[model samples]
Target: MKRNLSSFAHPVCATLAVGALAVLSGCSSSAPLFLSDGRATTLVQCPVGSDSCSQQASASCGGAYDVVRQSSASGTLSLIYACRAK
Candidate 1:
């Protein structure tokens, strides 16, 4: 009896192909990278203000000095940061 390719083909091989494609697509995503050039950058933790927005704003930039917490970003600045860990 002849075998069906779909049924005979290895499921693991198909799964690996799909996973590889997903990883490739993720690398091409236009989101954001956590760090740059590998330097010690300061993520300014601005003081909480009267408007109650200060806490929110600072929370946005909460991670290491360069980490982003908020949606809106300001002027670009040079940063000397390590692969990670600010």
Candidate 2:
């Protein structure tokens, strides 16, 4: 006799999907990355159609900053940068 397995599949798959999403969300650029020398790289997010992200990065660094990487997704722009030392 074959046991009915459909009843258990949906909940298990849903639980696993949610757990995976939670783990992946931590990988987003919202978190800051610190260098070995104590210099920290910040992530600045703004609307994709504006210069706000770059301006924000400059403000965060208090002067100038180097862009480590940048990407735009879902109408949001993400900029990862490290401030230049004075």
Candidate 3:
């Protein structure tokens, strides 16, 4: 008896194509890693066990008179940072 294998191949190819498209889209998507409203400053640094980054962000806030804390996502990042006034 003979059996056909083309049906299995079709699903495998489709899955691979979808995965490739996802990877390519992830690579090509362009968005800023940092952005701030006019009231805050941007800081890129470790605030590990301290509030250094947030403090600097506050100081760089151009006297906006608001309390600042690092965004929740801040600590999850593994990168050194700089400051920018808004």
What TM-score quantifies how close candidate 2 is to the native fold?
Answer: 0.58
Model 1 is weakest, by summed lDDT over 10 consecutive residues, at 75-84
Which portions of model 3 miss their true places by more than 4 Å? 38-86
TM-scores of the candidates in the order shown: 0.27, 0.58, 0.36
Model 2: which ten-residue window has the lowest total lDDT? 29-38
TM-score, cand. 1 vs. native: 0.27
Quickly count the clashes in candidate 3.
Answer: 1
Error of 3 at 44 (Å): 16
| Residues 1-86, model 1: lDDT tens digits | 88788775788688999999999998893633444464433333232333234433344446333333433235333222222343
Between prediction 1 and prediction 2, the one with superior lDDT is: 2
lDDT against the true structure, per candidate, is 0.46, 0.87, 0.53
Which is the leading candidate under TM-score?
A: 2
Q: Output the TM-score of candidate 3.
A: 0.36
Error of 1 at 51 (Å): 38
